[model samples]
Target: MSWLVTGGAGYIGAHVARAFIEQGIDTVVVDDLSTGRKAFVHPEARFVQATILDGERLVEAMRQFDVTGVVHLAGFKYAGVSVERPLLTYQQNVTGTVSLLGAMEGAGVHHMVFSSSAAVYGTPDVDLVTEDTPKHPESPYGESKLIGEWLIADQGRAHGLAHTSLRYFNVVGSGTPDIHDVSPHNLFPLVFDALLGGRTPRINGDDYPTPDGTCVRDYIHVADLADAHVVAARRLEAGDRLEPVYNLGSGDGVSVGEIMSAIADGTGIAFTPEIAPRRAGDPARIVASGELAARDLDWRMRHGLGDMVASAWAARKAAAPAAE
Candidate 1:
């Protein structure tokens, strides 16, 4: 039996796909290549060029790969852009997931690992968000991800669909030299680009209520995140029960100021980031406890902030031409 990884050409999806392949799991990748680079897909994995919205193609590819489960990672991921283009966001994340689930049902692929997001807990009031935290997603992107989780839950109730949704926070760093985060809205990429081009990177707000007067958020390494997904998939395959949701988060949290320092240290640059006015809807702190995931899914923050910055810089430097 093989696993179908949607959006396998994207950075995070590519890492998850590579992790699956390295672990000796049969893997097949289906990506639309809309925002994903074709070169990012793991060469070891079988690839199909198709969107999750294409039910016919999804079913055919699943069958062709003899897929037994799915790792749903394809979505319109930008929370900020989702506000401007809510329709497109819903279509990609919400409707796209619905279509993928339908195709999975058609193929009798009951097990799925939905790539949910921390966005589902928008501006959480609690210092440390747990899995039980009430979801109050702010943007259309976050709402769509929550809806995707609901869809998976509804399917599980309707049938014996063994599934789990892994809620990710600020995913950073690279698992391998060949793959790197390329999202324009991602913090690391944006900072790296600015620094590489001889521009000062700006922090949205440095006057928040946190210790460092900047936003505090969970940042997990891509390799560690990918490992969690692999273990989660294997546990499901082995009939091991898991919580419906898990937070792949850093319990202690790292402030934006700390991240800036890490970037400077990692890049051998000495410059304080420019502090711009606070972005709308910005929160002071939003760390999450990975205790539950650590217990069950082998989730842990193995890489330090310095490690994340260094590895990300290494990968970005490796792809200097495209990056510059």
Candidate 2:
């Protein structure tokens, strides 16, 4: 039996798919290519071009591939943009999850590892958020994710579906040079694009209450994040009990100012970031404690900030034009 990784062609999903393959687990990837790239999908994993919205197609894929579980990551993921596209976000994330669950039930595939987000804890008041943090999602994307978790939990209760949802913040870095994050809204890519285009990198709202007057967030390397998904999937497959949700955080905080410095150092660029006005709904700080994840899913920060930046920069540069 194989694992089906939805959105396996995207940055983080691709990494998860790669991790499963590396661990000698057969993997089948289903992606719509809306935001995911075909080239990012691992060569060893089976690829199916489809969206999670297509329940019938998903069922067919599970049966054909002999899928036993799913790593659900496909969705419209931009939190800020979700404000302008609530319907699209809900349709892709919430409704798509329903479709996937139905498909899983139909195909007799039970286990699921959902790629939830820290956005579910939007602007948490606590310094170090735990799994019990009160969810006050501020965006449609976050709402959809939280709702997806609820649906999954309900499904688990009703159908005995073994499942776990991983909630996380900024996912950075590249595990391999060929596979890198390409989200236009993500920090690493935005900074890399600025540097490559001979423009100054911009930071939003450097006048926060942080040590450096910038927002502080828990940034976990994408590789480490991907590994957690594999671990959770394996645990479920082995019939091990798991929490309904786990925060895959670094148990630390890194300010955006620090990230800018790291990027500058890693890229060998000497320039101060342009401080733009703080975007609306930007939280001053949001760090999480990955204690639960660490105990159960083998989650840990295997890469440091330097490694994260260096790897991301290298991958971004590799994807750049030859002249760059």
**TM-score against truth, every candidate:** 0.99, 0.98
Candidate 2 clashing pairs, residues 3+ apart or interchain = none
Candidate 2 Cα lDDT to native: 0.94
How does candidate 2 fare on TM-score? 0.98
Model 1 / residue 156 / CA error / Å = 0.8
Q: How well is each residue in 170-219 modelled by candidate 1, as lDDT tens digits?
A: 99999888888898998999999998889999999888898989999889
Q: lDDT at 4 for candidate 2?
A: 98
Return the TM-score for candidate 1, rounded to 2 decimals. 0.99
* Residue 33 accuracy (lDDT) in model 2: 99
Candidate 2 stretches greater than 4 Å from native: 322-324
Which parts of model 1 are misplaced by more than 4 Å?
A: none
Residue-level lDDT of model 2, residues 101-124, one tens digit each, is 999999999999999999999888
lDDT of each: 0.92, 0.94
